[model samples]
Structure formats: structure tokens, C-alpha cells
Target: MAGYSARVRGDIGRWQQAGLIDASTADLLRRDVEVNARQSLSFGSILAMMAALLFGAAILIFVAANWEAIPRLARVAALFAVILGGYVGGAVLKTRDHAAIGEALWIVAAAAFGGSIALIGQMYHLSGDEASALVTWGAGTALAAVALRSNPLTVAAVGIADAWLFLKGFDYYSRSDFPHVFVVMAIVLFVLSFWTRSQPARHLIILSLLFYLVLLATDQATLPVAIPLVVASVVLFAAGVLVPERVDRIVRLGGRLPLHALLGFLTGLAVIQFELADEHTYNSGFTLASVVALAGIVAAIVFAGRESRGLRWLAYLGFAFELATIYVVTLQSMLDTAGFFLAAAVLLGILAIVIIRVEKRMKDPATGGATA
Candidate 1:
């Protein structure tokens, strides 16, 4: 929000200089923005948030260290007091026009809620697993995020959910039904992002889905998991790059959906390349994978690169990894390796030409954004 405020101010100045608006009107707009920007995030507020997180951690650690010394009822009272104080104090601060600071306190409360769940479980000697406890904590935080409309709390919930997913499903071959619930968590968080407007949470959920898919592909020798990953990634990227208007109509992420979709495409291609490396037929399999990976990266640049710096960077990273892996696998074949680099150079040169042309046209007002 602070960044948004700055951009708005910059644009206002530009508009004023361009004579798009009168000086008086510009001053009025600046005043309005300045007044509203107080509620947005600032450097000090971020520090306060971090301080709240540290304070919560310190309290939890102190209590745990003296758990046996303190009376059980007093311990329970202290935990509840911590949780209530966080939320209530946050509300008070928000009402006093400290929105970011209040939200930071909400995060402290959320963390305390999770810690209390674990501590109470220990105190009662309850019979339940860590996965369940983490899930419950995440769900509670999510509910609080909804009730409070908190972006920070929503992001925190997504983090907790990812921790649970990784803890329970790091071994994809395990017989853990809990890990399979990641899809539900992803869907819920994705939908919840719209309500809380926590764009980071949306990004995290997408990454979580991709991480889970990669794990799902791991050790599933019976199924061709890489194929599905590649297929899905391509479809998603195409939907965003080709039919962006339609995709954005539903996803409403401006240009971010395509950026992340391209990332997913790269991850899928990387998975394919590595899965093929397992077969020992590195020449054929890796070459095929490299070709596909190169194509995907090029398509990203040609299609969505102009709008997504993230997509462009991801493509660059994918190209580097693809080249390195193929080089490693084709070490025995000097002729093949030389041929591969020469071909890659040619392709990249062509891509560079295309990019140069696109930039030229983008700079030319007559051509505008028609390069797409």
C-alpha cells in the first residue's frame, strides 16, 4: 500500500507536469492520498510488526521454559491473556489509526493461538498428531483473517498450512492421508486471498500447489507424473498468455497469473528433465527435455515477457539450468555438446532479435502494445 501510494503520487506529479490536471486539483489529490496513506504500511510499521512477532516468540519461550514451575491454571490464564491482549490491543491500535501496527499485533495473536494450541495439548496430554494440531492452528488463523479482513494474518495462515503440508508429505510415498488435504487448503486460501486482498498469500498458495505437485511426481514410478505437470503448466501458461483477457476476467490478477503460470511451466519442464535423467539414457531423454524447456522459455518471452519481469527472469533461470543439466549429462559426447551450444546460441540470438524489435515497438507510440 505504501508503494501504491508512492506510485499514485508520482503519477499525480506527472499528470500535473503534463497539464492533464490543474495545480489546484493536483494539490487536492495529493492531500487526499497523503491522508489515506497513513493507514498503509510504512517502514516503522514493518519494524513494529517484526517486534510483535519477536515479543510473541519470547513470551512463548519464557512460558515453556518455566512450564513446570508455574501453576497449571496460571499457565492457562497467561496464554489466554496473551492471545486476548494481542487481538484486543490490535483493535485498539487500529481504531487509533495505526492500521499496519494493529495488523502486526494480529499476527502476534495468531502465532500465540498456534503456540497455545500446542502448549495446551501438552498440558492436557491429548492424543493427537502434530499434523492435526498445525492444521487446526492454520484453520483458526484463517478464520480470524476472514473475520478481521487481515492480509498479514492470511499470509501467516498460508505459511502455517505450507509447514503442515511439508511436514506431513515430504515423503510422497508415505501413507499419510493428511498430506492429501493440501488441495483443499490451497483452494481455500486462494479464494480467501480475494476477501483479504492478500496477494502474497495467493502467490504462496500457487507455489504450494506447485511444490505439492512436484512431490506428487516424486517416487510415483507407476505413473507419468512429469507428463501431466508439463501438460498442465503449458495449458495454464497458454491460458494466461494467449487469452489473457479471459483469464484475467476470472483470475483478476492483472499480469501476475501469467508470470506464475510461466514459473509452473518451467518447474514442470525441470521435473521432466530430471525424471528423464533417472533413466540413464541421458542423451536422448535430456536432449528432448532441453528442447522442450527451451521452447517453453522462448514462448514465455514471446508471449508474456513484456508484462512480467518475473516470467522473463524465470525463463532466464530455466535456460541456465537446462543448459547446465544437459551439459552435465552429455559430458561424454563432445561433438553433441558442441552442436547443442551452437544451436542454443542461434536460438537465443533469434530470441534477442525478437526482444529488441519488441522493445523498439514498445518505445514507438505508433506501434504501442500490439506486439502481443
Candidate 2:
């Protein structure tokens, strides 16, 4: 984050010097960078956080090891003490300018909160599933994050929410409420990313959402699943890429969301291709998926390559995966694969022209051009 911040600041400086942005605007951008950027975790600070995690793990182990010998009330008190001490000490340290370590302590506290929930549930013989317990822990940690404005806690909450989804044990075909609850949890974490200013959490949430969509496609009928994914992803791509000014007024993550949206679009197309393959429409399906994947790779580069290296890397990785899978899937029919690429090349040229025009419009101030 430090390196990113410095690079952004330098770009803003050059932009201002080149008369692209006024001084006041540049100052506002700098302040926004300072307030919203995640504090970089230095090597020593990372080690300190690791140490804190180890200490917390040891505490949990010792408590569990002596569970029968320790009185029930003492056990509860000990867990609460650790939780309370972590939070209090973290707040104190942050006030003393130990921000990184303080955030790490918050993570430790969140871990304790989650463990305490599970341990207490087991101790009391509570009648609830792991999913419910996880949701409770996630909710508690998210509230703590909101109260403390802690990014680490925000990340922990997102992880817990994802774990709840995976550990729910709900059948894919069952009309279970757990999946819906998980979506709610993911949405809440996405909203909190803005308040906590945690880009990593936001990035994780985006990927998790896409993963959830893919899971849906696998769990349900492909046509029904693909429709929703394509529609929703198109909307997201429009919001995040086509209208940056409007998206900036709402949520901002340095233009990464657009690439995620594009990924979702590709995933939806891939799902359809597989569905068609099952119906013995392999060649047509492969053509559709291949052409779209190629266009998606190009769009990602055009939209995000200039400003976001991470997004560019992910886009390339995703394209590479698609190509590799296509090759393996069509190994017995190399000539058929060649035909798909030939068709894709023609379609890509047309798509490239449209993308170039869009880029031109974006750079034209009269066309409501807005730069991030």
C-alpha cells in the first residue's frame, strides 16, 4: 500500500503539472489516498502479527487442554478476558501510534471471539449448527470492525462469512436458507469494505461472489444460472467500467471491480459452453466461449492495464486458464480447435474496434470523461 500510495501521489503530481488536474483537485486526491489507503504492513509488523496469532493459538490450546480441570466459569472468564484484553490493548496501542500492531491485535481479538463462540457452544451443549455459530461470530466481528474502524477485523469477518458458506453442509438441491444467508453475509462484507477501507477484503469479496455464482451454475440448471450471471455481471461491468463517475460516487476500488465483472461474464459464458457441450453442441459452444474469452481478455487490458497491475495479471491468468482448458478439452480434434480460433480472430477484430471507440469517448471530456 505504501508503494501504491507513493506511485499514485507521483502520478497526481505529474497530472497537475501537466495541467490535467487543478491544484485543489490534486490535494483532494492526495487526502483521499491518505484516508482510504490500507496501511502497509512492514516485515517487522507482519512478524509481530504472526507472533500475536501464535500467542492466541497457544492460549486456545492451553484452555482446551485443561478444560476438565478448570472450572466452567473460569474457562468462560478466561476467554472473555483474552478477548477484552486484546481489544483494549489494541485501542491503546493505536492511540500510541502502533497502528499496524494494533490492527493485528484486532485480528487476534476477532479470532478469540470466534473461538469463544464455538467453545462456549460446545460447553453448554448448544443446539445449533456450525453455520449458525459462524454467522454469529462473523456478525459480532463485523460490528466490532464497524465500531473500531479496523481493516483487519473486516478481513476476518469476510473470511468467517466465506467459511460459513463452505461449512453450512446444505445440499445443493435442498431449498435451504443457508445459501441465502451467506449471500447476505457477503453483501454486508462488501458494504463494510468501503467503511473499513480494506481493498484486500473487497477483492476477496469480489472473487467469493464470482465463486458463489459458479457454484450456483454447478448446483442448478445451467441455462437458468447463466442468465442471471450474465445479466448481473453486465450490470456490474457497466457500473464499474462504463460509468466510472457514477461508480465513484458510490463504491471505489481503484478500477478492479470492472475486471472482476468481466471475469464473471466470462465464467457465465463458460458455463453455457459446458452446458451446450453436454447437449452434443461442442463445436458451437467452444466457438462462443472462446471468442468471448478472447474479447474479455482484450477488454480487461484496455480498461485496467494502464492503472492496475494486479487486475491485468489476473486477467491474463484467467485467459491463460481458458486457453489451457480449451486445448485439453479439444485435444482429439485439433482441426476443430483451429477453426474456433480463426472465427475468434475475426470477431476479436470487430470487438477491438468497438473498444477503441469507447476508449476515445472516455478520453473526450465532452463525453463526460472522468479519470480515476
Candidate with top TM-score is: 1
TM-score of each: 0.82, 0.77
In the range 84-123, model 2's lDDT, one tens digit per residue, is 9899999999999988778778878888888898899889
| lDDT per residue as tens, model 1, 1-372 | 677789889889977887789999999999999987874566887898899899889999999999999999999999999889888989899889888778888988998999999999999999887878998999999999998888889989999999888888764335565367799989999899899988778888889998888877774541376677678878888888778888876776765887887777778777777767767463587677789888888777778776665677677777777766776666536657678788678657765675567566445743342222
Cα misplacement distance, residue 157 of candidate 2 (Å): 0.9
lDDT, model 1, position 18: 70
Candidate 1 regions with alpha-carbon error over 4 angstroms: 1-40, 171-178, 221-223, 278-283, 332-372
Weakest 10 consecutive residues of candidate 2 by summed lDDT:
169-178
In TM-score terms, candidate 2 sits at 0.77
RMSD to the native, candidate 2?
A: 6.2
Summed over model 2, clashes come to 0
